[model samples]
Target chain A: MKELSLNILDIAMNSVGAGAKNIAIALDEDDDSLRIVIEDDGCGMTKEQVEKLSDPFYTTRTTRKVGLGVPLFKLAAEQTGGSLDIRSVPVSESEKEHGTKVTAVFNKKHIDHTPLGDLVSTMVTLIQGNPDIDFLFLHTVNGKSVRLSTAEMRKELGDVPLSNGEVLNWIKEYLTEQYKEIERL
Target chain B: MKDKVALREEGSAATRIVVGMATCGIAAGARPVLNTFVEEVSKAGLLDKVMVTQTGCIGICQYEPVVEVYTPSGKVTYVKVTPEKAKRIVEEHIKGGKVITEYTIGNK
Candidate 1:
């Protein structure tokens, strides 16, 4: 993907496909690196699935012969002398607390690293596509942070759906303003 | 939440354009297709007149970069949409209010 945000969006879709009701995306940027952690309370993979996740040829999609999201992300991280980590515990009726976690660390000043694209749009798309899910996004750039929680938004919204255009506009403006603030700092 | 009520009061616009941007769509180049729609719609000053949003997984990955248009008339789905096609969609279907049948899902 040309943008890191695209990669995030792609990976996040996997969580949705796994039936995650709650997804958390955290981006932390320090002097040396930009780290992303995306965790989901979704049906997770087995040990074998987790092990083969990075292989381009391995995918659960029957329509296509290959899945490049993970492998491409792995390459993006590794090219910058960074790393990608994936952990999952398969879900079972007996155990409800099973899900998947993915973390990618990228060198801050790496020349090859793509800029994180419109993340607010990414978040909004996720919410709009899966309105019932709870999305919590935390972005900390040099310790200046902006946190957004849809669960809290829902509490405030009462019976109003998140799909409302007005609410979507507000969310966009709020995130854009926060992003500008971080850029200024 | 009150804001949502306010939006509902605003009611549905006469037309809405939805772009599929799921992983399948994006991998097939829906990002540019979406960007084109947003840009064209805004440039045409139809931001308030029309609603442009995104969706996930139309369940037809092979036919992606799919875009769907919803008007009072009905719904039309376009497949394998590129930026150029998106421009035409805004100009012909959206502006002219004529469904582009040749590019529609039913045609394929």
Candidate 2:
């Protein structure tokens, strides 16, 4: 609960690191349910790799092998009376691919969760900093949806580096504004 | 607490150094680099000249321990930073206008 956003950031970073050109993130909140989904078009993993991805000690990257990201995501969802699903498909026929899509669903009204502000901030931070990967986000409340595309924001900002203080500050303000609209519900 | 608004209004003239301090950065020795910058800045009696802050992941994990310097005109990103390089940055780049060519991503 405390670090749900951090977990999300870590997962998204993995996608970008996998050479994904496009990433999609969705959060749908209704009176009874909340669904979170992250999909990336990166190099897909083999069945064995997917099986080991959540093992907490398996990773192919040069980074540390303590694979806690997916495990943490799964734990967070399960703890909230939810479930997680991960699917991967290979990019090539001969070579085993490693692209992955993860989805977690929760009964929002029942789960003890962190504030939405933190989640949005984490998402914004991830999206702003990674210009090479495009992010698509959709948030739904009571059947109505508010969608945001990082590509659109990038266009508006005119290639401003996400790490630039001005850009980060602007992203924070944008997230704050969007959350305010959500709160009004 | 100084709100982000107040911090922003003060602008780069306020002289803040933001170090990428996430787990990735820390694993690459960003803590020591950050510490060196802070120590050097204080030792030079330039505490008022700069404010040091830490930020989470910047998405360039391959280039961990990135440091950013913001001035009145623009921002400069120094990638794969190190403690020794950080001290040199404070002594040369911050204190003087000349950027340390060796420590920059472009130079590398």
**Clashes per model (N, Cα, C within 3 A):** 0, 8
Error of 2 at A123 (Å): 2.6
- Runs in model 1 lying further than 4 Å from the true structure: A60-66, B1-18, B28-64, B69-77, B80-91, B94-97, B101-108
lDDT of model number 1: 0.81
Give the winner by DockQ: 1
TM-score of structure candidate 1: 0.79
Error of 1 at B97 (Å): 4.1
Over the stretch B1-108, how does candidate 1's per-residue lDDT look in tens digits? 474254332235678888887667877878767767766786786756787777777689899999999998889999999999999999999999988888998899
Look at candidate 2 and give me any clashing residue pairs: A43-A98, A43-A99, A44-A97, A44-A98, A44-A99, A45-A97, A45-A98, A90-A97
> Each prediction's DockQ?
0.29, 0.07
Q: Could you give candidate 2's per-residue lDDT for residues B1-108 as a string of tens digits?
A: 113222222334457788885556655666557656756775776655576666767778789889998776568889999887898889888888677777777776
State the TM-score for model 2.
Answer: 0.61
